[model samples]
Target chain A: MTMKLWYWPEIQGRGEFIRLALEAAGIAYEDCARVSGADALIADLDARKGRAPFAPPYLDIDGFTIAQVADILLYLGDRHDLAPSRIADRYWVHQLQLTIADLVAEVHNVHHPVAVMDYYDDQKPEAARAARQFREERLPKFLDYFEQAAECNDGPWMIDHRWTYADTSLFQLIEGLRYAFPRRMATLTPDYPALARIHGLVADLPGIRQYLASNRRIAFNEQGIFRHYPELDDE
Target chain B: MTMKLWYWPEIQGRGEFIRLALEAAGIAYEDCARVSGADALIADLDARKGRAPFAPPYLDIDGFTIAQVADILLYLGDRHDLAPSRIADRYWVHQLQLTIADLVAEVHNVHHPVAVMDYYDDQKPEAARAARQFREERLPKFLDYFEQAAECNDGPWMIDHRWTYADTSLFQLIEGLRYAFPRRMATLTPDYPALARIHGLVADLPGIRQYLASNRRIAFNEQGIFRHYPELDDE
Candidate 1:
């Protein structure tokens, strides 16, 4: 049976990470919210009785539902061969994915530092301060860690020679950061050659290439986690 | 072989969640940072060659190391019977743990709204704003979701009658929140009867009671993730 993914239809947000993985694995699934309106998505989520997802980007597969971007990736990794076969390696890949999730959350926070419910216009000054710290410290620290992971492996993949879900997610992270802080990423991107190489490699993958060209991939905008406000970017 | 847990020596932070699970399962492991020094912990983390952890609260078992609190708990859950036997149930439990992790991160962010590297005092204004939003919206939303999970189950546990790592982690989450925001928690506690019930049940567990009475359990302090700042709390 075809799996169903429920998320906000307009923005990629966390759901894009899952979309990338399914596309990479050439798996068949329906983007439920995209097909049905977001009201339907909310109703479906509200209707879930037990073990309900806390937020969107939940997948309903074979009668069971899973949520949390990293957890969903972990479930997908096991089934789609998107992770290493060895148990230790699988955990390591998952650890990397969890770290990526942390980075994504921080990226969202840069624009919404004081209050998630508040608008960026209300938090712009705080966002500016947050963006500076993120660009200087947190972003570099995370990039360095990912680059180290790539360097430890045999090739551009997170694991030895084989690309895992972590790598695809990493590609999305780099893409998001670059879009959000083009000047900052431009200055720092050269320092992390391994990450740059992995990003390029993931972009060239046939599945990712196809997905990127398709209309199914939503363009990053102010509404999504990674927004370009120009002022949030630094040189 | 005895497992080794590495985290910041002083604060409960993320490490406490893993500690609670291990304690609940009656597993004996070394709190490596407490035995050694923080310097040693940093040296150990820095010295690892490949597949190194992004941050602390990593567990070294047998030969491999697992990082990320949820991931570490997932590993321990499988070996120590800390989670359900069924694969679907295991994933559901893990999903709950991940949500708890998200809440923990948000709690930390409430104090460090602008920059994590900066002192909380530096971001006091921003933190005040964050704390208001957290208490007004995020905290209630999270509590409501977790309470629903507990209510849906056979008992106070997140899953059926048998308590899992998720239950232990939720217990800690509630405890930390109370310690951090007593006034806010006092007003909100009655609204989440299931969570309060689970907290009471977990505290009564022999292993947890022993751990709490022992020197192993660190007292809640300002340095920890759940800092009890009077200004941050509201009635």
Candidate 2:
């Protein structure tokens, strides 16, 4: 089966979740935009008629395109055995992924509190206040929720003994948080041992290890969602 | 079959989307929190172990609980034929619902830009700035996407000739946007005729018409995600 993933060629952003899943599952898919340039991605997106993606990070499987990180992950989890076998468990995994998506959106809003169209430099004061709330409240709350979810099962994985796409996404979420707010994360990391354990487990996976070391993984930068602005990080 | 929905009893928040679908489909459901109280909803949510909802607006069908507005809608769409019959169309409807959820989050943020936990009075200036950006850029972009989606099919609904859960949710989104940013919506609403048509179509559905007139429909208030703060609305 030929599968193609389209996203911004530069930043990890939301596409990283899809990439991590495909990599962890050992699924073979082409990164379309990365190979063909952003212009190709734009042209491809614009050319589509009905039922197109609202933004980047969409996967074209055989001919069908699936957009939205959680939606794409749901499809991947079901097809590649990244999710559980039971229907309820599968929906549970999707719920966890949706929650993770929520936290990710808030993380982006931390740096772009006032508006996405405006530059971070223009909204530094607002970002500072948002960062304080995110660091003190939102980050810990989301981490605590994930920690509870991880603890629900006997194993370190979010669902059963095996790792699901949620685990992989959670791993990326922790990595992004650490990168964006090192000072605050350093203080909070110790509190989420289950999450940290999952992070380590996902990293240790053969596929993930190979992908992270390879050039496929884009480095998080100011243009991406989890940007490290020192003024926005606090302990 | 017994279905119960748990959300804040007071406000027509995210839960309303689920409520709209259920109502539009003529599916019988108990407004659990509204009937019992907010404490009952809290206790029910807190009682769930492993694979629980992260927040309110979760639907308990039989005994299985489903959370996340989009996930809940997807389930309802399948069970009650509120979505398209085709798998691809169903996923398309889901993608649209998720985008609506994104815009809804932004609308909430417009009122509480700095922090969700903090009072709007404390962050009026930040909210003012956020509202301007939301009104100017994000709002139109989202509406344009939805308009295009609605236009893709030869009907007012998002998918095809028949209305899907996406149509119901889109109706709610337009209502919320109008409530939150009256002047801005007034200026922008005419541009997206497709969305306006969908909004009217969803409202006129027999089930929706009855529900809206019934006491089950919670009135929009300052406490809900969509609030009419005159200061935040501008043309």
Candidate 3:
């Protein structure tokens, strides 16, 4: 049976991470939200009786539903060899995934620092403060961490000579960050050679190359987590 | 050899989740920061070669280190039978744990909305705005989700007849939220009877009860994730 993924249809958001992984692995799955409407998405979510996902992008596979981007990736990684075979390597990769998730949350907060419910226009001043800190401290810290992780493995991949979900996700992270903070990312990218190499490698992968060139891949926009607010992007 | 768990010593921060799990499982582990000092904690973190933990509350066990609160709990849960044996059940509980982690992050953000480095006083206006939204929309959504999760399993535990790490973490979440937002939690607690019941069950667990009574269990304070700024709490 094909897997079913549920997420907001309009934005790449967290759902893109899952889409990239599934595409890279050449796994066939249905994007439920894109096929159905937003009402269907809400209805499917509400219909889930118990222990339902707090929010999407949740995946239903093999008679069970799983939520959280990292958790979904972990499940996919284990089944498709997108993670390490050894126990410790798997945990290490998972730790990396969690850190990436943290970065994603912070990126979202850059535009909506004061409150998710409030309009970005209402929180512009707060977002400016948040974005400055994110561009200065948080972005460098995360990029440096990943650069170090890559150095440990002598990699374009997180694990030596092997592309896993971490590599694919890192590719998406750098892409999103670049789009969102082009000026800042341009200034900072030169400092993390290993991350750049991995990003390049992930783009060159056959599955990813095809997926990106095809219409299935969504473009980054202001509505998503990584929004390119000109005022927020700085060197 | 005993496992060495490292975290900031002063607060019952994220480390407490790890501590609670270890104590509940009757596992022996050394609190490295408490034994040493914050300087030692920094040195220990900085000395690590590569692919090191991005932050504290990392556990060193059996020649490998694991970080992230939920990931560490998942590791301990698998080894100690604090989680279910079935694969689906494990994922379900993990999803719950991830949701708890999300709540913990938001709880921290209530006091530090603008930037983590910026003082709370510097961002009071923004925090006030953030807290109002948190208390109104975010908190209830999370609590309702967990309450439903608990209700799904006929609880005193997240899963029927079994207490997993999700239950323990939920216990801590409730305790911390109450500490951080006394007025708000008091008003909200009655609405989530299943969660409150699980919280009580966790407190009464022989391991947790003893841990709480002992000096080892740190008290909640302003320095931690759940800080009680009376201005931030309301009905």
Could you report the DockQ of all the candidates, in the order they appear?
0.89, 0.75, 0.83
- Candidate 3 residue runs with Cα over 4 Å from true position: none
How far residue A79's Cα lies from its native spot in candidate 1, in Å, is 1.7
List, residue by residue over B1-235, the lDDT tens digit for candidate 1: 8999999999888999999999988899999999998999999999998788999989998778899988898888877899999999888999999999999999999999999999999999999999999999999999999998888887657797788998899999999999999999999999998898889999999999999999999999999899999999998
Clashes of 3: 0
lDDT by candidate, in order shown: 0.91, 0.90, 0.89
| Interface RMSD for candidates 1 onward, in order | 0.7, 1.1, 0.9
Expressed as tens digits, the lDDT of each residue in B20-97 for candidate 3 is: 999888889999989898899999999998768999999998668899988898888778888988888887888888
Question: What value does the lDDT take at residue A127 in candidate 3?
Answer: 95
TM-score of chain B of each: 0.98, 0.97, 0.97
TM-score of each: 0.98, 0.97, 0.98
* Candidate 2 docking band: medium
Ranking of candidates on lDDT, top first: 1, 2, 3
- Give the per-residue lDDT of model 2 (tens digit) for A1-235: 7689999999999999999999998999999989999999999999987778989889998789899998888777767899989878887888898999999999998988888788999999988999999999888888889999899888778898898999999999999999999999999989989999999999999999999999999999999999999989988
Position A226, candidate 2: lDDT:
94
Tens-digit per-residue lDDT, B151-226, candidate 2? 8897657887888888999999999888888899999989999889889999999999999999999999999999
